[model samples]
Target: MLIDILTQRCNAQRLMIAEAYQSMYGRDLIGDLKEKLSDHFKDVMVGLMYSPPSYDAHELWHAMKGAGTEENCLIDILASRTNAEIFQMQEAYCLQYGSNLQEDIYSETSGHFRDTLMNLVQNIYKGKPVLILQGIREEGYTDPAMAAQDAMVLWEACQRKTGEHKTMLQMILCNKSYQQLWLVFQEFQNISGQDIVDAINECYDGYFQELLVAIVLCVRDKPAYFAYRLYSAIHDFGFHNKTVIRILIARSEIDLMNIRKRYKERYGKSLFHDIKNFASGHYEKALLAICAGDAEDY
Candidate 1:
């Protein structure tokens, strides 16, 4: 069956099969699958068909399309992705939707959240001398004095009593390298007697607060941030399986291993245990496969 084959085939093999299916039947494979399948099975199959960038763009579209914005989706895609990944998604968004990703995000979001998203989508990162495929850096802070200065700049940006200069905050968070910002965060805590995240929470409200917190957490510990996101996605009011699938699939090759370890350490249970509890059927099988294996105890 198509469903069975889809669940079993690798992405490349699936792409080939999709091509063959369309050639043979003169119908798009996803269209045919949608016609035949229902519910989550259909969802997973369709999700699998998209090349990664297209998949990222499609997720962004769905996140912004409805009445309410899915801020978690926005943060996950915008906050956690590498510079090259974001660049690819922006291109894919324009190509697929015939609109600029940045312009669409600006229209959908407002204030500091929008500011942060706009800067993040630009995919600008600095201080890397070597050419990397995805523009992810392996470098750390190079100047202590610069870090301290940036730290004070960040503290002043958020610590204002009358008005929080969110532009300055966004500039520091968006433009600074993660390694540089990590030092800045540590220095900010020393200077302000509060963590930058705590400062953001106290000074700001709504999606802006959430976006800044996500950025700070991402800089501090990426795997930990994702682990927490996965837990929240599954444990929230209604099951957020879409988030679970998106995060799992997107991070599978990148840092799922680290995420799994951090999730287990933080949540007192393995990600595999949680996934099994929350998901099932062929869809669950596909997720578990991407996860590589179950928990050590499981």
Candidate 2:
């Protein structure tokens, strides 16, 4: 049905696709998206599909093949999507694969990347609203003075040469709610007269710092940073494949439209043009579809 919808140029095709899927399958069209698409199209469709976690291990297996591991694609797909989508994807993955997506990723990837992605996937798939509420309450409820001291301790640990603090920071950034962390970030800035993210950057390096920066920049001003990422990945960084895939796959559904606008404003050229110049094959097609702002089509 999504393929049929995409074949036509009707303005109502997206709604038609949605209605057709819901009526026929008793499920959302995102599942169909997984079945019907590949490369950047799959990425964009997954973004717009928005079912309660409807992507399965088979679809994930296919997407993660070729030049990248399914593990990495799973992390990118799950991390970029909303929590509701993640939960639904987890359910679908477990049902179809006979194993949890989280468990599969844990087994497949290793080190801090694996750990950070697992923590994020777990939080999203947990189906617990109170976890977020509890995190928000943590510093305020358990003695403010003690909470402040503990936060300082955490910060100090982050500054140490050993990686334990870095691990803790990754866990915090990956697992904590952005809303909750926003408040904590504000408090940290108030105390130190500098952004907590800036402090983290000063203290860390390599992939650890990259992940930290991704989270902080995402939280601070996602669109602008994405614009910068797109620009840097294509022009400054000489079309780094992983970076290009990561930014495009991550933003296609949520903020590609904004990123496109920013790209035009920043570079005096459309992002679509730059993407075309730098990328090819199915990946380029998918990115073009997303930049065109018609992601609902499969």
Candidate 3:
């Protein structure tokens, strides 16, 4: 019943429904649902109630709230979002929590990896304006000479001291445009006889390494990056519900249609099949609703 109603209503419709329920019953709709729903299914229902930015803000709060940080959540949200989206999340975080998102993240994390996430959320990098390729339609402009120089820089960075390398990778990965990075990636391979992903794997460890790899993959193919995340959540970690929920719900109206195709191509099975197999009951139904498109396995 909950699945049927939510699956049928868009966010606006859901809000209207909430208002009608409140007026008719003289009780808060969300509060009632919260009291009733449990586990990941509850999370899905509640998440469906918030706007995307609001939901993201809530996730970041919870991620940073406990003693330890959910670094993957930070990386996934901060690194993958556009400058505009980050700004929106920043505002939402402030409005929802009455706290600065950067300060929250700052207190929770430290060192080079923290700085990279800061640059992303704070847009704090000074000097020359970095082209934001996350949401804009590229003019398809890329400088071959500049890419070669940057590629050489990365190769050289790999040889330098650890501090120097972290600084270099942070600058290149965070500031450069997508097309620029794509060219630099190819050049890096040609000059070094190794993939950039492999280079990061060789040089770095911890959250820093993971974030850099995620950035490279996102630049290469955002949907495919997400598809791989889904695969890991579903298979490698035994239906990591929060990760699955975040990706599917957040990307549903964005690039999920493409992500579905990429998942099938990469995994030799449909995302729907995997979700159906791994997740159960209303939880599976909710995820499938977000994932719904084609019925056939690829």
Candidate 4:
């Protein structure tokens, strides 16, 4: 009954049903599914039943649990989300695990990767301007002078003999509105004669480099950023299914069509083709459904 309803209902409705089941039965809906289902179906059902924050927290838990950390999972959840979304997940992580998400990430990882994740998860509750792409389109950029100043600050930060200024970089990335950052990036290119990604790559190393580059790409073009992420996740020695599922599910409604286009342009293969090749069975079917398109020829 749960599986049928879950497969048929939308995510919001399914969440409602899960809550109803828990309230009525006195057992967690996810716990029941774990008992009743097996394999990929179980994973899908359980994923579907979770509230987005709970699901993210659960993924973060598994990613950090054991001998090695799943850095990609951390990037996917921590890097891709908006500030408001991060705050909610932080709360959920604490509520679910009785521990701080930021501290947990720090304990599980080290150095630049830990710093990058910490920057993302902290200060998320601070009031920042809310602006989606469409909102930016409608409102346009407000401050060109500030953007130029920020661009200069970023250049100096990157140019320092030791390394980029951690606090300054974090402050700019965290505090600036997305729209403002978009302008800042353009100004950065104009002033530095190199894209931020190139500068980051030249100056930094390891996951910190990757994280900063991801932030720039996301600010410049989110769909393309995700497209690059999706490609790297699948085109590697072994496909990272967790990354694949997370990206597909997270962006299914937002800009996946654009992501698909970017993927084909960047990788010379369709995302659907990659999905069909890397995944199989119900998992494949579920991914293709969320993708909302058919496979394409290479």
Over the stretch 171-257, how does candidate 4's per-residue lDDT look in tens digits? 576556778888888999999999888887897777777777777777678899999888888887477777787777667656889
| Better lDDT candidate (3, 4) | 3
Off by over 4 Å in 3: 19-26, 124-141
lDDT at residue 43 of model 4 (Cα atoms): 76
lDDT of 1 by residue, 13-109 (tens): 7789889989998999888778987777677778878777888999999899887888779988888777778778978998999988888899999
Off by over 4 Å in 1: 1-13, 123-141, 161-164, 295-297
Q: What C-alpha lDDT values do all the predictions have?
A: 0.79, 0.60, 0.83, 0.75
Better of 2 and 4 by lDDT: 4
Best by lDDT: 3
TM-score of each: 0.86, 0.63, 0.90, 0.83
What lDDT does candidate 4 reach at residue 40?
63
What local lDDT does model 4 show for residue 298?
Answer: 30
Candidate 4 ranges beyond 4 A from true positions = 1-8, 20-27, 39-41, 124-142, 161-164, 294-298
Error of 3 at 208 (Å): 0.6
Encode model 3's per-residue lDDT on 85-173: one tens digit a residue: 87678789999999999899889998998888876775444554435523321325588999999999898877673787778777777
Best by TM-score: 3
Ranking by TM-score: 3, 1, 4, 2
Q: Where is the poorest 10-residue window by lDDT in model 4?
A: 130-139
